[model samples]
Target: MPPEVIERDYGCGDPSKYLRAGETVLDLGSGTGKICFIAAQVVGPTGRVIGVDMTDEMLKVARTNAPVVAERIGYANVEFRKGRIQDLALDLVKLDEELQVRPITNAALFVQADGVAQKLRLKHPLVGDESVDVVVSNCVLNLVEPKSKRQLFGEIFRVLRKGGRAVISDIVSDEEVPEDLQNDPELWSGCISGALTEEGFLRSFNDAGFYGIQILKRDEKPWQTVEGIEFRSVTVEAFKGKQGPCFERNQAVIYRGPFKAIAATYAGEGNITQGGINMGSVSKVSHRALTEAFDEPLTRAQVMAIVSPFIRRATSTPA
Candidate 1:
């Protein structure tokens, strides 16, 4: 879906590329069904796509476009549930008669509209634990309050089947988010106030039982700058398994044998020292190289070359 159709398209990249056919995928914080609609194409008819959004207005727009989009592609596998990402309780029934919706109680999939900051109280008449194959989120997780972010991850863990993966793209800060900046309403709505430091963000996933987390891609451009707070757009991949992340972690596995160097070598006052070197302000090195070099990026060859040697160890056991 285009940004013009729905203005809140702040995603870093399309995550549906990683989804497999015939797998059930869930989109948390799904806004206007942009990614959900796109995911429907990839998953096919046999697969399912459930889009959960808290905003009624957004859900209205999403539902309006869902039929058209699905008809255009000839599949009705995509669905939008009106509920919060953190607390999915659209199927719950209260003892009193006032708190009931006939359609929600009867539907196969029901989602509630509640803020992720609160604890989720879900009744499993609809979706259940360990039921989904993949969970995808785009540009919305950062807006969630810090206290309930863990529960949000736990909810993802609870819904995912074994070997399920989460592909998400969000805004991440390079440094700690100051309390004052975090509390700013403008920043909060703009997707910066609730931003997590890159390390802290990954740790949250690990703490919630996700393993083998790795960055698929990272953008050099800063998306939003509020009160001098800068952030990056990163697409991350994590698995709900006991094994280590597919990408390298802290472990420094040496390249057992010398192979090849594709790029021309640069020699100056300061330059990257070839294998697995992180050169940046953090490294305190000023090399006469491309701006991309200072970014510590992986060239096509370099990214492929490191696959054999890198070994990642889980920093903590799953909770």
Candidate 2:
């Protein structure tokens, strides 16, 4: 809402556009609080918005300008906290204040600081467990240290209620970034070094126990190119509540194998003889010979179509 926030804002996507009224929303890496402010309005007077940022300057601007937005909106329902996105329970705000009064200079003091931090986490977590309705992030998750990335994703998964979802917009690489490139501090800060590959991005959500994941948007052209590698924006929507007791839904899997085929159909159909499929292999050469008539992507899609049918069926019987 403030011009200053707008000026300082840097984001790859707007995750808050999907917010609903009366929901508790958490904005991770909410630099400048632009998304948080917009989300506050979207969530309305009854809702609450919390923005977390590790940067003092960004937090300063965000906290200073939050009241302005609240006054304009006729309700104050947004707050900013100082916490690392990867470890939300650390409560950097409280740590800063505690250290000001008594800095840790010895092993005992350091242990005391750790104890205090543990207490803060248990008693007053920056974002409580299963307390948020939605977790939104705009171009920030990649900024976290690689060692802490899995934990960061886990935090996002943890803070959300059972049915909560995460709407994230961040940069993803077409291929795996090299370790050398990842080690570069400049690239790391620029959102290039720590980016995940497209597959890795989706896998992160699945590994974090999210399901029903879908790509909402993908930039066709590279946002930046380096070493012939393309880096682009991808917005993904993933849900947190799909992990429930597995009761059979009467979904029977049908298997059709060695589909009957003429010479045309014999193409890419794994070793086909005049009598049907022989015990031969469907080499890439044969596959390409049959499908090269179409474009490459379609050829791959066709191959995928053929492969998708023979999926490993669930071990269940009819009720």
Candidate 3:
């Protein structure tokens, strides 16, 4: 990585460690391209890494340093794009180029510009659907505006291929952040005010229809505290491809010792409890069995074998 990128980088945790070789990766809010550069090397020459950021200055620095990193690594598999994380389909760079030709200076032109943007989104999306193998972010999710956060998660889920996963590292508050704190520009810019509660952070993934959600890491010490609200760093991993039809194969899985009662989403229904007892319907039990199996001392192949029949390619359009 270039010294310029390293100096300008800001993050709470390393999501690159979770990446695998030869996988396509998307780095959200990739300021200075630090994480993208690291991910490029980790994913190797066969893999590809795309960084997206809305800031022009950050994008400029990243685009400039990209060639240097590629030269050092002897391959050019990393590129940066300009767009909002929430709306990955709209290419802001392309919009800028179009605006230079047909500038929007009046109300009528502005409305026309909106149509042009929509056309660009349809014709040339910044990130295509079901295109990436992994989506990674480092301490940047909280920077998104509160109203657009749901769309942000949906965009992450949209660009991912079936069975693809997201590894995110961000600050989470122990308690809900107060409205006053959230409204403060300084706190929000500092990545403090917009922090979601730890439970809410995980729940957001669940609500986004991601399964096998797990906390890869959580800092023991608080990163910061505001008005008795403790904020700490946490790395979360969630998988896509849980949406599909459930077929009964008369499969049964024995629950090992662990939690007395646990809830899971399966068969397009609400929580199903399993309390150290055998459960049926392999197709219905989506996350709990897979999550528990992963928590145990089982290999990736073994874990896949356990959920292979249950896993199906998602057919519905991404939210």
Candidate 4:
């Protein structure tokens, strides 16, 4: 990483640690491309990393340092783009160039420009739909305006491929910030006022249809305290592959009692059979019945039939 990038980095945690090799990664609000550069190395030469930021200075710093990092690492797999994290489709740099050629000065021209932006979003998105294997962010989500936060999460979800995941590290509040604090310009700019409550942050991912959400890390100590509100850094991981049809496979899983009772839900709406008992949803059968049904060897055709749905579901492209 370049000294400039390190100097400008304001991240609360390292999301790159969660990334895997040979995976396409997108870094939201990737200031100075620090995380993007780190992710490029982790993902190796076969993978690609893109950094998106709305600030020209940040983009410039990131773009300038990208080649240096690539040269040092002996491969170039990272690039920086100019765009808002909440609206990943619109390339602000491209839009600016287009506007220069045809500046909007009137209401009619403004409407025309809006149409142009839409066309650009459709034809040449900065980040394409279901394109990235992973989306990672560091200390940036809290900086987005509250009104645009939903769109930000939706954009993250939109760009990720089915079965892909998002690993995000951001500041979360112990309690909701008051309107007075939220409206404070200094606090909002400092990444304090716009912080989501810890539960709200996870709920945002859930609302965006991400499953298997987990908090990878949460700081034991608050990073900042304002008006009795304790704000700390938390890293969360969430998956994006629960939008397919359910099939009845008559599968039953035993619950190793950590809890008195457990109920599980799947995208296909299946029930978990535990200890010869049906929990809920789908079909129910005793353990002996399930075992006896599959006790006989399955012919080749029967085996294919049994697994074909899973194979198709895994390979099918996301809409």
Candidate 5:
């Protein structure tokens, strides 16, 4: 990092350090080009790093110093853009410039601008769909408004190429943030008021069709406490890649159990989910059966692994 970069740098951890060479990285809420510059080295000259932030001053700081960082790193592969992470397809800077050319003064003008913005999103998305190999954010996702959280995660999913992943470090609440705490503007900007519950954070990734969710790190102690709620930092890694169709290939899956014991089976000529499932285990899952059943949407390979033994045994049996 350059001298100016080191001075203005801020983050919970070094998510960029995990990037591989020749990658196309998208740094969400990249504050001052520090992480983007660091990532530039990891991705090498052939790769690219795009930093997206809504703050004009921060964007200016980042863009001005981009050349200095590039010279130091021996590559000019980093670019800064104006955008909200939640709505990556809409480039606010482009919209602003367009508006300046034709300022909206009435309802008709406002409606026309909206139409133009919609066309702009489709034509020159702030971040193109499936264009990025990696998405990394540090203490930023939590700062998104609650109503926009789903959009934010969806944008992450939309930008990532299949098999690409998102590595995020941010604060999470031990419990849901109360309405009063969530309403505090200071806390919201400080990355506290809009924090998701740890479980809720994982569920969001699942909701956005990501899998292999893993927690890379978690702070040992709470960063802050609000109304008896503990908020702490955690680095989460979630991957995107669940493509293709479902086909019955003589596969079966029997969930293993030690929680409680009884047995059930549901296998037939066309419906083979073989073996005895522990019905007694129902009590253990009764509280949240439906919700937990599809928590980690298994991949095709995962399903094959679970039923491989059955397939092997049946193949070797007499016909």
Candidate 6:
């Protein structure tokens, strides 16, 4: 792989520290296998790292790098599968259509020119329910269509073992955005405009049945801004366990010492503040930058600040 591939690529944050050796790890939107390769090293020979990507170009790059990386690291424990974050399944429907084959009566009967069926092991979304030890993502969740974002988190929670963890880094907005901004596909794909407000982000995890969702690290750098809009990157860590929601449960709290937070200025005349419950600074981040400032859940003041505008717009809906 070219050095630029590793250097030029943008992401929310590094999510590898939370991983452990001999543990199965899944990387959502695993672009170019950057996180996957790092994760493969952490898991060692006994463990596995699965990279899931919606873009074929990215998967191609990741798949191409797999063998070389494995050779260099001396471990063939990493694999990449192509699929959307919301639909992590192998997408048999697409595969069948691409190969111009009818649906197979049984999984065993399915076959492709490249043996995609066998390659993907037909496990799809592949982690299997309650089968994975950890799930890591970098700046990919914001790209998912809003309608499927909830299901994405639900799937992550479903795939995790009882005490598994979901560590994510993505761009997030300080407040709800105007409709024109949200509709802009450029902003959407670039990781801006459609970002979940901090409250909504944490709420989505809670709604998906995750416990102990905390922000382990964050940066206050706002990557881009237009007009009055601003964005930042965040690294969020949430666990699947007996504990309750981080924000709702009084005891749940964030551990801020693992990663250092550096303050960066926001654009277009705005100020961001961290909430009482969170351990990092709250700053407006672009969609691409959302994954960088992954800290504790937003504070009550922060939550209200992030949600109130959207609520007003929602209630103002015309009947």
Question: Which candidate order results from sorting by TM-score in descending order?
Answer: 4, 3, 5, 2, 6, 1
**For residues 1-319, what per-residue lDDT tens digits would candidate 4 score against the true structure?**
7899999999999999988899999999998999999999999999999999899998889989989999999999998888999999999988999999999999999999999999999999999999999999999999999999999999999998877889999999999999999999999878899999999999999888776678999999999999899999999988876464445455433544444443444233543333532323223222232224322335689999999999999889687
- C-alpha lDDT (0 to 100) for residue 9 of candidate 6: 59
Predicted candidate 2 versus true structure: per-residue lDDT over 180-299, tens digit per residue: 889999998889999999999999987887755789888898999978789999899877663333343332221123344434221223333334223222221122223333222235
Worst 10 residues of 3 by lDDT: 273-282
Record all residue pairs in model 5 with backbone atoms less than 3 Å apart, i.e. clashing: 264-277
Tell me model 5's lDDT, rounded to 2 decimals: 0.80
Q: Candidate 4: minimum summed lDDT over ten consecutive residues — where?
A: 281-290
How close is every model to the real structure, measured as TM-score? Answer: 0.66, 0.75, 0.82, 0.83, 0.77, 0.67
Task: By lDDT, rank the candidates, best first.
Answer: 3, 4, 5, 2, 6, 1
Tell me the whole-model lDDT of each prediction, alpha carbons only: 0.69, 0.79, 0.86, 0.85, 0.80, 0.71
The local lDDT score (0 to 100) that residue 213 gets in candidate 2 is 73
Query: Which candidate number would show the highest lDDT if scored against the true structure?
Result: 3
For every candidate in turn, the CA RMSD to the true structure comes to 15.2, 13.6, 11.0, 10.5, 9.0, 17.4
Screening candidate 2 with a backbone cut-off below 3 angstroms (N, C-alpha, C), the clashing residue pairs are none
Q: Which stretches of candidate 5 lie above 4 Å from their native place?
A: 248-319
Residue-level lDDT tens digits of model 3 in 1-319: 7899999988999999999899999999999999999999999999999999999999999999999999999999999999999999999989999999999899999999999999999999999999999999999999988898899899999999877889999999999898999999999889998898999999988788787789999999999989999999999999885466655444344445355544555234533334222233334344344645422235689989987766653344365
lDDT of 6 at 173: 77
CA lDDT, candidate 2, residue 176:
88
**Model 1 lDDT-worst window of ten:** 262-271
1 against 6, candidate with superior lDDT: 6
Per residue, candidate 6 scores C-alpha lDDT tens digits across 236-271 of 877665322222234323324324433322211222
Q: What CA RMSD would candidate 3 show?
A: 11.0
lDDT of 5 by residue, 136-166 (tens): 9988898888899999999999999976889
What lDDT score is found at residue 88 in candidate 1? Answer: 56
